[model samples]
Target: MRNASIHPRTLGYLGRALSLEYSAVQQYMTQAALAEAWGLRDAADRFRHETVEEMQHAERLIKRMLGLGVAPNASQLRPAGLAYGLVELLLQDAALEAEIVALYDEATNFCRRIADTENAEFFNALLQDELQHAAEIETWLESLGVARRTTEDERAYF
Candidate 1:
């Protein structure tokens, strides 16, 4: 934490983002384990990789909070829901990424309002990363030929 002043609203948003990132890490890790148990080795690996990325995002938020003299709060995490199958898991992941993208967008705007150019840029980059994650999940789902209509079809289970 530095001696410089940080906007309270900016700090609050960062803390929320940190907690969300922690939740994402937990969700991805749990999904990875579930995929492995279901014999989806490739999906498991991808989930595990995403788990690492979420952890890294959390670390970045923590470091930023510390640099601003604000304590990082990872305690208010959102509960992660379990998916019954691979398509469901992918849908959940895409939804999670979309939520994260929205959060980062708000955070970036908040940082801009506070004249915190550095943090604004950081959040922007994070937003880009999350968008990419969501896009990849969408592509994967499409590759499986799982359209919206087939999302809940028990026969679509792989």
Candidate 2:
């Protein structure tokens, strides 16, 4: 293992990513419960599975930080308060995934610009998963028609 000191900015980025992963785990678990309450069995199962995946991502980042002699930090994680409706919950999750995609893409691009191929690859893999999650959520939302109805209702009410 190269004892090369990871750049401070890179470490900061990784720390934030770790925090995000932790937050994702929490959010997915919560979503799973909400889905179950709403009688969305398949969606509940999917969220539960996603929670596990998020934990795995957190573990991977923790290992990488340990290897680089840095302590993983979770202080930057944002809290997701209670979601009211099913549509609200799903849209919140989708938005979170979108944010994650943006963050991962930025981190990977930074790594590539600095010639850090390994880190770049890691971020790219995570980004790909985030994008897939976003797309899946979008598809689910379309099928639910909640977003369309919300928009139409808002326009009519306003």
Candidate 3:
């Protein structure tokens, strides 16, 4: 692909994605430290793993932006969602994963609509990964007896 011109909206989506991914990395890293301080070593390790995964996602987004000849700037990163307990952190993570899933899904659809197979495939991969992460979190919640189908006003666990 020589001298390619990426659509502005697509760039917007990519930037938004990079921001969310980096935010997730921050969230998970903070949660990991919190868990460690609380003496939940296993939970801390799990969050650390999540941090790495989210970091990988951000890296991929940066690479994609560069491939499209754009500066890889994650526009804004949200504050890390913090909680005192492991379950609370997991709940926050589940909600974040839901948001990521929606973003990737929408981005993938937009790319497909514009007949950009490469970008569509990229977004779809991220979508699949986030979906799996969401499912794992849901299962973890279930295992801990904290899983509940959320009400209309609540963030969904599924």
Candidate 4:
């Protein structure tokens, strides 16, 4: 492996991100399969599209790691929860996206602190992507008359 000149923490974050991206790919694909089994054609298609997008994210992270002379690690994976219904799936996806967005935001801050503007920008872009996904999921959930979380609940947390 080529010597990655970046800080160790930066490398650690990138590796974690790579692992998460791979996990997302697996999760989305599995969701797609489950949707198909449940005869939810539209949901299945959306999940498949999400699976492809997650794969693309993983590929980009791997390429970036390799470019930095670091080997990408995908070992830090967790089991993807198989939601019971369409509404559950949307809620799960929204939560997952929110988690990823927070992680990427932290990574972006770390990159900026280390003066790696390029990586910081990359992480920021990922954050935006995830935020959009989260918003879409929330909208769909609301349209389906499923309440993942109420605004009052959020207010209580603050």
The numbered model that scores best in TM-score is 3
TM-score preference between candidates 2 and 4, better one: 4
lDDT of every model, 2 decimals: 0.81, 0.80, 0.88, 0.81
Task: Summarize candidate 1's per-residue lDDT along 30-99 as a digit string, tens digits.
Answer: 9999999999999899999999999999899988777777777777877778878999988877777777
Q: In candidate 1, how many Å is residue 40 off?
A: 0.5
- Report how far off residue 142 is in candidate 1 (Å): 1.1
* lDDT of candidate model 2 versus the reference: 0.80
Where does candidate 4 stray beyond 4 Å?
1-4, 150-158
Compute each candidate's TM-score over C-alphas: 0.87, 0.86, 0.91, 0.90
Q: Residue 9 in candidate 4 has what lDDT?
A: 81
Output the lDDT of residue 4, model 4: 53
Instruction: Give the per-residue lDDT of model 4 (tens digit) for 75-105.
Output: 7886888778988777778767767877888
Candidate 3 per-residue lDDT over residues 37-148, each given as its tens digit: 9999998899899999999999999888888888888979999977768788889888888889889988999999999899999999999999899888989898899965
Local error of candidate 3 at residue 9 (angstroms): 0.9
Distance from true location, Cα of 8 in model 1, Å: 1.1
Clashing pairs in 2: none
Measured with C-alpha atoms, the lDDT of residue 14 in candidate 4 is 83
